[model samples]
Target: MLEIRGLHAWYGDSHVLHGLAMDIPRGRVVSLLGRNGAGKSATMRTIMGLLGKATGEINCNGVNLLKLRPDQIARKGIALCPEDRGIFPSLTVTENLFLPPVVAAGGMDIASIYALFPNIRERGASRGTQLSGGEQQMLAIARILRTGARLLLLDEPTEGLAPVIVQQIARVIREIKELGYTVLLVEQKAHFVESLADIHYLIENGTIVDRLESAEFAASRDRVERLLAV
Candidate 1:
């Protein structure tokens, strides 16, 4: 549902992404696999208009987002859950979640979000800082879901998360996929994405260098290992 082509991004005088191109098909989860500094997160940030200057085409469900601002990109049904997990530390869990205006139809109600994250439901009155890392991550994802965003940009969702919490996040991702949301996932944990993604794109330098569909992964496991090692 999202298409990117010839995309480049800059932060002041520093250029990060260069002519990166990729596509996220509808109702499917695609993982961006790469080592650190491979521009996986930069791709996500550029797609979400988080960078100061972005050029080229970023069309979401046919709407061009490269020319849009960060908030404008969000209103077009795209949401980014950054690695840092942005949350309002001063606000209560419930308050932080409902703060962003729902820009589209089908935003999840409180019951629905709470159902996916039971821990969050229980700590509805607690301040954001009072939650654990996992809980904070849940809150971040849930907040975006409430915006009724059709596309989700999840950057390193399992980074530094405990094994059990990673499993929980993986399960929730599967559930989210089944609900028809499109996801572009960035992850270094190959095993975590094994059963979840339909396609895996290997990035290097600043662009997609290779890709393996689900059927090709088992046969090409060694090549993928070598590619990531580069």
Candidate 2:
């Protein structure tokens, strides 16, 4: 549902992405797997128009994303859940869930979001600061789902979470995918990506070095792991 071509972005004088390109098909999970500083997060930022200086093409189903403002980009059926989660510290879970204006018509309602994230439902009255890291992550994802965004840009959703919580997050992602959402995931955990993503893009130095389907990833497991190993 999204296509990026020759995308270059700059944070002030620091040019990060260098001709990055990828394709995200409808209802499939595409992952950008890279080491730290490899521009994975920058790619996400550029797609969402969060970067001030981004060039080249970021097309969402033929809509030129680069020309739009960040809010406008979001209104075009895209939502980002950054590494920090971006939760309001003072807002309760229910309040946070309702904070973002629904950009389109397909967003999950409160009942559906609660059903997908039971933990969040249980903590509906808890403030963001009162939640644990995993709870915060779940809330972040839940909050975005209520925005009616068809494309989700998730940055490091599994990072720093407990194994069980990671599993829960993965389950949620799978459920969303089954429900026809397209995901552009920026992740470092290879095993997690391997299990969840349909195709993987290996990025380094702000460019995609290799692209692998799931079967290819299995065949080249050693090489891919070596590149990902820190």
Candidate 3:
């Protein structure tokens, strides 16, 4: 559902991505794995049109994403749950949940999102800043669901959560897949990706160094370890 070709992005004069290319098919989960500063986040930013200087094509569902503004790209059915969870600290949970509906098509109903995340339902009236790290992450995901985006660009969704919460988040992702959404995920936790990803790409120094199917990825533990070990 998404294709990036020969993508090059720079922060001022400091170039990051160099001729990076990849494709994500409809209804599949693809993981972008790399160490810190490997340009995984930068790739996500570029795709979302958040970067100041980027050259290349980001096509989603046969439309050119690079030509559009960030809000326009989002309106075309791509939602990003960033690494920091990007929650509005002062907004109540219910308010945050309702925020994305303004930009989303068919709008995610409260009941459906509640069913997907019961924890959020329990904390519906609490302010964003009052939630725990895991709760904040859940809120982030729930917010995106409200958008009803067909393609989800999730960056480090499990970054700082506890094991149980991470597992819960993984289950939610599986549920999202069952609901027929395509996901492009950037994750630092290798094991998390192992269980959830259909395909994997090893990104280093702003480029994709290796791409493998899920089975092949699982069998090559040493290769994954060597590439990501810091």
Report the number of the highest-lDDT candidate: 2
- Candidate 1 Cα misplacement greater than 4 A, ranges: none
lDDT of each: 0.87, 0.91, 0.89
lDDT of 1 by residue, 92-208 (tens): 999999898998778888888888899998999999999888889899999999998989999899988899999999989999999899999998877888789999888888888
Evaluated against the true structure, the overall lDDT of model 1 is 0.87
C-alpha lDDT (0 to 100) for residue 75 of candidate 1: 80
Cα lDDT of model 3 by residue, 125-196, tens digit? 999989999899989988887886888889999987899999998999999999888899898778999989
* Runs with alpha carbons beyond 4 Å of true place in candidate 2: none
Task: Indicate the residue-level lDDT of 178 in model 2.
Answer: 95
Q: Where does candidate 1 clash, by residue pair?
A: none
Best by TM-score: 2
Cα lDDT for residue 183, model 3?
93
lDDT head-to-head 1 vs 2, winner: 2
Ten-residue region with minimum lDDT total, candidate 1: 221-230
